[model samples]
Target: MHAIEVCNLKKSYTQGENALDSISFHIPQGAIFGFLGPNGSGKTTTVRILNGILSPTQGSALVYGQKVTANSQEIHRLCGVMTETAASYENLTGWENLDFFGQMHGLSKTEIKNQSEQLLYSLDLYESKDKKVKAYSTGMKKRISLARALLHRPKILFLDEPTSGLDPESAQNVTQMVQKLAIEHGVTVFLCTHQLKYAEDICTLYGFIHKGNMLGFGTFQQLLQEKNSTIYLELRGDSIPPSFTPYQNANKIYKIPITGDTDASQILQGILKQGGQVYEAKQIHWGLEDLYFAYQRGVSHEISTKSNDL
Candidate 1:
């Protein structure tokens, strides 16, 4: 079963001004699903709706086949959410804050203490555990909030820019922890962020949004197919064969449109048969960052063309 599902999900705060369009997607169990968009693209809005903080204007959202609205409490019990804003109180010590939230999750005192200590150490905040949250640095607060979220051992984690205030090392640690939770612990992670490079590193699935509209959604391989990504081969070689005639470019480079790895090998063999002395060959495929920009540009161009046609 999908960990989370949305069907024609939409939201509008004002007449004729939709904050979220008819977006739909499903995150499979144990998958790290990345919700990617620029600010004001409705990433956070969708998160709030899924957490049952807001109702959709149309359609539905479900967590494990239970509707979010009618089952908010049960959903909360099964999920842990850490937003950009830390939910812990400034007056409470880090340990105290975690303990309080753990109890709220109905964890036993011993379980809460053990989980809190484990999280603090893993997040590099153990040394500061007794410090009041107000006295802690932004990174420390973020770590504490994360610890609180995980204390209950929820099956699903909703993280919004989880590494925002962290140093590079801490950020990497958090990212690694997220990977472990999904892959090792069978947790479902829904990550919302503008951190393209990090998202590219960890997310198993991705959905892109722009101006409240879902631009696309799929696994990396699936998206590569959907985008029909081009395969270009750069080579420092001599003499292109007649078979390679269509692929010649300035310099010694050639652009080969290959379907997959096998085609690349075949192309190399063809080049060799034609007596081309290949000094170096490099394959370039579009990554998440490249695909994102391409999608945006394509959308803009389509819109402009439509206006022109009109």
Candidate 2:
């Protein structure tokens, strides 16, 4: 069963400005879907629509086949959302805040207590559990908010910039927990983040958005193949072979772009035959950063061409 589905979903504000323009995608069960985009690119807008915090101007979103608009309460019950700015009572202690949310979710008193304790420990907040939220640091508050989101054991988890202000250690801990929830607990994660490196580390699939539109959606490897950017071969040697065209790099390393795996192997063989000792023969694949620039460049080129035509 599909964990989340959005069909031609669109949203516009009062100024007749469309925030999202007919975006559509499906996330399979147990998959970590990374919703990537720049700030104000409608990533948060899409998350709000899916959570039923905001209604779409057209089309719809579904969680486990349930309509978000008509069955918002049911959708809420089945999903957990951790936004960048989550609300909690400043006067309440961290433990109290979590306990309150757990109770609101209809968890039993004993269950709420147990779950709160476990989550606090897991999030490394056990020591701070008794401290009031107003006294907590930004990282501490973020951790507490995440704990609240998971209190109900929701099947679908939506996290928007979950680690934005967290320290490196805390961020790594949260990332591991997210991966474990999706892989071991069979939870579906919809992660919206600007941190491309972090997204690459944990996401199973990616949806790249720009200017309120989805540029592409697929696995990382699939998107890389579609871009057909290049596979750079770095050869470390003092001498260059006659058969190989040396790239312009001042270092002893020579770089070449190969079309595919076959060409890569052929280049290696040719270098070996010419008595060039290869200290390093590594394939440099394009990362998410490369794909983002390529997509942005395409958009820019299209806009420029249209302007010229007009």
lDDT of each: 0.84, 0.84
Report the Cα RMSD per candidate: 6.1, 6.3
User: Residue 37 in model 2: shift from native, Å?
Assistant: 0.6
- Candidate 2 segments exceeding 4 Å error: 260-262, 299-310
Taking the tens digit of each residue's C-alpha lDDT, what string does model 1 give over 1-310?
Answer: 8999999999999999999999999999999998988889998899888988889999899999989989799988988999985478999999999888988888899999899889999999999988999999988888888888888998999998899889999999999999999999999999998888888889999998988999889998887678777766656678877677667776776666665577778888888887878887766677787777666666311110101100
**Location of the lowest summed lDDT over 10 successive residues in candidate 1:** 301-310
lDDT of 2 at 267: 83
**Candidate 2 residue lDDT tens string, 1-310:** 6998999999989666889999999999999999988899998899888988899999989889988998888888899989975667879999999988998888999999999999999999999999999999988988899999999999999998889899999999999999999999999999999888888889999999887888888898888777766666666775567556447355767667777677778888887788877776666667776676677565311110101100
Q: State candidate 2's TM-score.
A: 0.91
Judged by TM-score, which candidate is best?
2
